[model samples]
Target: MQNLRRFILKYHFIILFILLEVISILLLANSQRFHRNRMVNTTNDVVGKVYEWSSEVGNYFRLNSANKQLAEENAMLRQQLSVVYDTTTCTYDIIKGDTLYKYIPAQVVNNSTNQVNNYIIINKGAKDGIERDMSVISTDGIVGVVTDVSRHYASIMSLLHSKSVVGVRFKNNQEIAGLKWQTNNYRYGMVEDIPTHIVLQKGDTIVTSSHSNIFPEDLMVGTVEEFYPTAVDALNKAKIRYATDFSTLRHVYVIKDLHKPELDSLKARLQ
Candidate 1:
């Protein structure tokens, strides 16, 4: 109270002058139609600006949750697609009973692109049904395969990893090959062992092949950017622009093969 009193005494003249000025301005504005209109417009303009800023700030804070919701919705929609389910009956007739895959929505908590064996960490883990060798993908394309998991988190072996390779095929001709990343560039990778006889062209779409049990067939991988012959073999290789940008990746869906256990058992028996 003493401090307040001292401050008021010290600035009394200045404060009174400001108050007088404000009163004079208000009186002038009230007396003149033009002044009053300008004052009203100025007040509205300031209030509108403050409201806009407040709205934008609120939206900024809500963006992350909104994105997570969208990712979950996308996972749901992807599960509903015909491609995720088998439509074949015993007689080669169309049926919709066989469900082949399930998508588990996850948020990318950590990721790396500039590494020999880059890995991605996701929010979903063993409890969410993420398992080793399960495929991870963005809405646009493949992201990686699940490698390690805890109760609430999982690690993904990113496609950008040097040892990583996905069995991809040309969308037009179904020519299968392996896509590998050694370029050390996250935006690009090479698909090698493409037979030279298979005519290659720029912008040719590449997709996951049935050869890979992990990823569903026909899932998009990337587009061919350039093609050239390898020195050792008659096979050709192509540089491709990856569909998923690892550098800015955020959301991913872990693909769970519904019949994976049966398939694994069959393979184990063969061995």
Candidate 2:
């Protein structure tokens, strides 16, 4: 206790000087409005700097989420680009008197290309005006036709299936034929019954024939890959390479023709 008293006595002058200095500064700030304002401004500046630093750190951490959202948006734009520039199908112009073209966009939930009787499930159904025999197509090319429907989902008969057949014609000469998959090649299908007199070339574009109501005229099917003349008959058979890559499909459009039933009834009466 005596040693502590001696130390305090020795430093008493220094401690008293510090206390006096603090009191002098406080008095100056309270007595002068200019000094008070200066202190307040200094404190605000420090707080403002701290807040700015914190906000920048938070934005840095959210960069990954922002990048993912941008990527998804870009992918959707690319799909739309393909649809707009596709030469096969006609798009709706929505003029005053035009009623020929109408399309409904949908997404694929399930698809199978390896099965014999392959099917594709879409997100649109009766609620969206989808029905049996409605044509399904992607931005690049034709996909299939709707075969079954529920309230909000529909099943489609894929073009890759062996039993699926579509009436198609050449774009150059309008020579019509039946297109069917052979089940061995997923990328190619067979076009049969084309007359031997029609001239053909490799890479000639083929499209859906207008004779049937299932698909509209000039809807792209594929390009001619190879062709051969029949051995015993005057007929030509050709292999077609599809424009759409069935293995990587995601978004598709369902086509519903409002006049389809009227057209069907007219044809039935003729028969």
Candidate 3:
């Protein structure tokens, strides 16, 4: 404190001169219209830049919320697509005014792609209208099926799981087959039981078949990247490039079969 006082005393004259100079400049700027306008312009420019920086920072923080909102909007839009409204399956359930399928937007809170039984956890569950056996998909293609659910979260069997299987068909010829993960390669899946007469080409898209009531018809599953004409147990198989990138999956939609209870009831009578 004593040293600061001494320094202030020593430089009092210089400080006084600097202050007077600043004051005089301000007075001159205020008195002259041209100088006053320039000062105002300079101040406005600096303030505008500061506000712009602040706005950018705020937007950066809100990016997650923005993405979630967009996902929800997309889910609503998907619900309207003709593929989801399977008119052919409309039974008495239709007389009750129930839509065939509905989409529930969800955020992936956890995921695993390396393990043999890879699974995904989403930030939605029974409370959010999600349930067991519901189908999960990303913007690009199928991701998994719901296996379990809590009030606020649900577990999904990722398509990369060894036990996971989806009924898929070639988009061109409509030849159906079973798709499953046969190896640890998360980037690829496998399709088995390709029809004897069916021939596959490079990049042939595989889509979900109506047989899998869990998913809506024609949802993209994957594409055939390579074919193995060799048979295992007298069955033909092919390597399918995964349509959904499990490693980077973040957002997904859970599909609900509105008439599932009615369908299950009818199947139970057969049993």
What TM-score would each prediction reach against the true structure? 0.67, 0.64, 0.65
TM-score of 3: 0.65
The per-prediction CA RMSD against the true structure, in angstroms, equals 20.2, 27.9, 21.1
Instruction: Report the C-alpha lDDT of model 1 over 134-239, residue by residue, as the tens digit.
Output: 9999877999888766666677788987667799999999889999997479999997788878878899999999998779999989999998866678888799
RMSD of 3: 21.1
* Candidate with best lDDT: 1
Cα deviation of 159 in candidate 3 (Å)?
0.7
Global lDDT scores for all candidate models: 0.78, 0.76, 0.77
User: Ten-residue segment with the worst summed lDDT in candidate 3?
Assistant: 33-42
| Least accurate 10 contiguous residues by lDDT in model 1 | 33-42
The digit string of per-residue lDDT tens for model 2 on 32-61 reads 432111234344345434544554565566
Compared to the true structure, candidate 1 yields what TM-score?
0.67
Tens-place lDDT per residue, model 3, 1-271, is 9999999999999999999999999876664432111224344345435544554565566678668857776776656643657544544243346568888988776677887777777767678988778999987899988876766667787887766778888999988888889757999988878866677888999999989877888999888899878644566778999888888776789998888899899999999
lDDT assessment of candidate 3: 0.77
Pairs of colliding residues, candidate 1:
none
Instruction: Select the stronger candidate by lDDT from 1 and 2.
Output: 1
lDDT of 2: 0.76
Per-candidate total of colliding backbone pairs? 0, 0, 0
